[model samples]
Target: MSTLGVNTGWRARAACRDHDPELFFPTAHSGPARAAQAAAAKRVCAGCPVREACLRFALAHLPHGVAGGLDEDERRAVRRRGAVGRPVARPGPRVLARRARAGGCSAAQVAMWLGVSTRTVHRWTAGGAA
Candidate 1:
């Protein structure tokens, strides 16, 4: 038994009516028309009850597809600014080594602490002073 007969209605539509590419894809003008469509998509997402869920599902499953009214750029930005309460990681070894050396830890000692080669430590020291 397929659920294709179910009447999902406009409420379940992912994109806004105004921004629906179905309307614009055929007759859209040049840049201006595309911009208008993007704006419309964002507006629909702004007040959508299922916005987050829609976005999450889109990103998790169809990472290449736009959903919840967001295009690729908007969805990427949303994912980049995620606020799920986890702390951000600091910069990598070169940055850490420079900071440590600046704070007076010798290159070898910093290497020992960080478990990296002394050549790496020297490279960081050289890069930082540049």
Candidate 2:
């Protein structure tokens, strides 16, 4: 059920591709369960040939869950530290809104990550200015 699109090359080589995706979106909010889930996901990234590429992709495209061996918080710290040059602008607001919703996080959360207002995110989602 995989769709073809950008990053297909690196993604094809990703080790996590063989595992359940929910593993990357840890069900637990915090404490032991969350740590275990993140550890499990990171194990997949530990040996991935496309690990760097995946990390770069996550830095730009992912706003929640575990990706490229790091959780969303970790990625946020990385972004703040300016450790990578990933572009966070490839997807327009609408696309990001859909992705945010699909990821079980609010578009407002995504907008916060991107330094925009929640109302602005709502406007983007509705295809209008608020």
Candidate 3:
């Protein structure tokens, strides 16, 4: 059931429901502890059965948290690529390169597959950003 074009049922199944809200919304990037805090938040989201729903909700309503295992940058990347409802994992470089080459594609083309920047594809292909 939805009150305003949003189903509330998913909250019952969210992994962070019982966790501290601050865990998902670390306050500062400059702080040395922020990275570790975000990682801890993400670990909770990593196994969430409702991750997709959470991402969609985050994209629509929540602007500042680790919903669906993604931080602000990742969510921005998803939004910039017009993939509002679909959450996708980064493509493995070897597999993606083979497929890209098979299609006669470029790094930009590969980035399109995962809603990331061309630079991100390069990093992924270079064996980084997993």
Candidate 4:
């Protein structure tokens, strides 16, 4: 794990996973005990930047798994929500083509300047974003 930036490497993002705080609250507990864990989960999630990702992963893999400090049951409640109609849309062909042909360098040159692999550059040129 590179200790250069606060949010650069996979190790930084995976710090929580390494600690495995989810193991502290097992599902074999009673009703009241479960409630206590849920409450604790909310407190932990209050400071987690990756809370959404955690919640989504938990909900999608329900009956087991934890996210945002919450276990499976808690995660499900978060997922039973309606969309806010944020108007999401993907980039079109022309936009990709334009990105592929920046200045006179092309996607290959741009990828090299950026210090990425050639296959990545080819993907950009082929209109397949990284």
Best by TM-score: 3
* Residue-wise C-alpha lDDT for candidate 4, range 37-122, written one tens digit per residue: 44344445545776555444445554554455556654455555532122213344344334434423455544444446656666
Q: Give the poorly placed runs of model 2, Cα more than 4 Å off.
A: 1-6, 85-130
- Per-candidate RMSD, Å: 17.1, 14.0, 10.5, 18.5
- TM-scores across all candidates? 0.36, 0.60, 0.62, 0.39
- Backbone Cα, N, C clashes tallied per candidate: 0, 0, 0, 0
CA-RMSD of model 3: 10.5
Clashing pairs in 2: none
Off by over 4 Å in 4: 1-11, 22-24, 78-130
71 Cα displacement, candidate 2 (Å)? 0.8
Candidate 3: segments with Cα more than 4 A from true spot: 1-4, 90-130
- lDDT of each residue in 1-130, candidate 2, tens digit only: 2323445477877999899998899888875456556656876876899877788878878899888767898899889978786533234446645555455556656565545788776766664321
Model 1, range 1-130, lDDT digits (tens) per residue? 2133432344355444445455323234434344344434445566677655555555544454345555655456656888323332334657756766776667777676567899989977894641
**Local accuracy of candidate 3 as per-residue lDDT tens digits, 1-130:** 6746899689898889998888898876733245445656777887799988888877777778788878877788888999887646754445544445344456766565445788876665664222
Model 4: colliding residue pairs: none
Instruction: Report the Cα lDDT for residue 68, model 1.
Output: 58
Candidates 2 and 4 compared by lDDT, better number? 2
lDDT of each: 0.54, 0.70, 0.70, 0.47
TM-score of 1: 0.36
